[model samples]
Target: MLLIIVGTACGAPDTTAAEGTPETLETFTTTADALTVQNCSPLPTSSVLASGDDGAGSVANNTRDDRLDTRWSALGKGVWIDYDLGSVQSLSGAAIAWHQGNTRVNTFTLYVSTDGVNYTQVYTGKSSGTTTAAETYTFATRTARRLRITVYGNTLNDWASIAEARVCGAPATGSSVVWRGDFETGNISQWTSTQMVSADRLQVISSPVRSGKYALKATVRQGDDPINSSGNRNELVKMTREAVGSEYYYRWSTMFASDFPSVKTWQLFTQWHHEGSSGSPPLEFYVYGEEIRLNIGGDPGTLVWKAPLVRGQWQDFILHVKWSPEASVGFVELYHNGQLVLPKRNIATMFPGMLNYLKVGLYRSDTVTQVGVVYHDGWIMARTLADVL
Candidate 1:
């Protein structure tokens, strides 16, 4: 049975709407879009914070109110609020009110704004790891008062409570903020999350680990594949953000623990589903549904590897995909580390011209029931094919 899981467990995409559920961003209708009030508050004067159940004090009414389509965790330290800035504020610093006792293990980020339409990040936390943890940074005073806090809890059920959040300082001289994701310091601005398991199954890890310097890792135990998207004991990864175009480059290095059995069907896949389309079909490159398609027995584009990917070692992947006016005439090139494993100029084919996003993670189901983990890092860039190559 499908448990309500938590708050309005988002039903799959309703393409009928302008933007799918995941892309349905909330726009602020008041001044309080500037504050994030949680667990403790009378609701700020000008904030978008709303009161929601954190799985306690209420029965069927228990729910988590997070902006992103997915919840941070089923464990419940995950309560958040987000709002679109109608106009950027001259944000300088913030005053956070904590209801629960202070904690020293939760991390948060602060994003900036200008037009209140797009966001740019300003400050990130390096130390204060609690809801009571107040931090100030030198962002040269920007005109972005809007923010989104993605709380990463270090302690499992130790929830972080926020009474109020405030932005201080006047707008920066001439700086106009466009886009931002709270408190992201480094490459976190490019980060995204996806929940591939059906809600009926138990998926405790709301966030994956960043392996290597910037690797996106996927770890699973022996009986991890509850939904069996790929059959066998497997795990799947899908994009959290959507992107479509003809001139983008994505590169990342990967390493997998060799638990794949010799007789199991293992393959890497990139599934893309358009915004308003319906079907169980997925756009794939290496493996198309139940068949192998890559660099092995068939044409390079549709061949499957006789030998499985090397395990216990790191492998670099450099992908350059370019769009052609002919819709289905695009090109895809894959490079292993520095060496070209899947040659350039190869014509790999998949789905309807436009794409919502790309899934760049591991998809495997070994013959033997065992554990599996894939680690990745390095640069994740989305730029012109020329800039990437």
Candidate 2:
């Protein structure tokens, strides 16, 4: 009974077994995860131009520079700071980490605009006078290119000061976010473990980050294997241990090094490996020669999507999957570089009763002699497309 119960719990950690244990009446599966705080990475802004500033160091541009030590301060009640998203985008709110926020409340009004000249008021509120952390203020979703926040001095003084600010994006569809493996925690502590030759195999770097302050730089050399897997790898494992019938939307970004080897073989940067030890992962995103391909099924897998690989530039991907053994019930949808590249396709995503876990980094053929490096960022697993978006 104990062995059966353990095996039935999402296939356990056994991969050599031919079939996974079936779910019993007592077996429980989690379908959804906790909802996020609507704290989407601050929408990217092209340029920040403010109406005024207080001094040389407390300049208008400091608010969006991703730094809290710096601030944008101006004297007066109606002073404002504005931002241009570079292009029109779906906006839902604003997040502000106010200067001296722990001691005072700042009254503010949020506005949005498409042409920068015609602005529409979206929200008017007061900052919570308790913490200096970024506070997200949500409102009706709107499409705009510019965002302005006018502050009416805090309770303590007539100075409008903000340490950092960001425009939050509206969910394009859903909102139930499950987990985030993004390197926002300053390290790889969010992951379950690592499959690397050494500690330098996976480094959390702050520069060249897609969003927030940090990203993972995975480096793989020939014969590098910490888990003794088939291929050489330096991968970060995220043990989601997703169950059958579970659905998730995963959003992430990857950038290949400019000198990444272009050998005529498979080089996987992202994959969802099954519990078993051999064969290909049921679902994987790999670079074959000079092309990026998304494959479903194990050995001799079906190539569902493929594109010419571009190096030195970030590639954004959103993968929506229904975890099921039945081909008719499980499916995969992909959004690449902000466009729907692959529509939902009915297919088996899990192998029999086998469950799946996430692995990110560089995993490739062991025969290749050249070293490979890849940057991964913004790994978010959500129940809704909007949450990942």
Candidate 3:
């Protein structure tokens, strides 16, 4: 009877017979780790074991009993642990126990996952304050294999402890999300605009099409001015999100005024910045047309120009930027409609860090007011600078 009870209380760790006992679970060392994401490296690999009442512990077989770190307060009877779904997996259920001796933890939330790529809260409940801190809760669904337990701030202790993680589920069901847009309605989202300083009359059209593209019209207008000063000169559509420590390649298209005359200097701007928490100057990239040239990292250079402007015509353009440690320059190619036009080299240098925003739109600096009427259409697509080349 004693042996059967003991067996029921402690379940064996999951592992392949050929793999032998793997390493134990280790504490996640960084704050960025608390968020759900995949392919994270530079993490410590040793499992964390509880200190015997002294709050001191050492590394052992982490695979049998793993530990996760939580930013919650380290106060009374609370529980805190993180689950790494290994690769992206479909997670649906979880079971956890709050150390009963510590009375600080009174609430718990169970999170579910799919693709280990993202997680969503699935269950929540209050601790009775009397039950064995070592209690378990079962979930009805069976879709997730990665589970996590988060304790609300405890009154007695700020932290929580986990005795086990029983993940039961299958792998995620599909490919990655191909595309998405969070429309603020009549506003531009997921797009960067490029117009220079002193430029005006930019507007992000919200109605009529309801789900429409941003464009320039003889009389229609859509634009927003950024609160930053560097952008004071040229009006532009900028990407709200940014890349870090890597190069990026994205493409957008525009329609020049059918009436645009040859030799007219106009700029279509999309810029990124490397910023500090307190906010500071950033390395910038500026693209314009006098035959498609660029200003990178504040250094001015010209690639080449093939297609001039045909009145009332639409053209597609590609901007490729590389910023890895090996190479530190940005490259850009301008295409007419679909054909490659002039391609430039070492157009600009990237800053040491990533910029906070990506911008786009049309302007001509001292002459922005006149060219504010150019039409633009297309989506802005981007990936890590390393992925594209």
Candidate closest to the true structure, highest lDDT: 2
Residue range 279-351, candidate 1, lDDT tens digits: 2122333322233234311111234222245666765555665422122334566665576655555342222
TM-score (C-alpha) between model 2 and the true structure: 0.56
**Clash count, candidate 3:** 76
TM-score of each: 0.39, 0.56, 0.41
lDDT order of candidates, best first? 2, 1, 3
Predicted structure 1: clash tally: 29
Give the count of colliding residue pairs in each prediction: 29, 1, 76
What are the per-residue Cα lDDT tens digits for candidate 2 across 244-329? 44577999999999999997777889888776545567888888778898888765557899999999999999999987655776
Candidate 1 versus the native: TM-score?
Answer: 0.39
lDDT of each: 0.37, 0.78, 0.37
lDDT of 2: 0.78
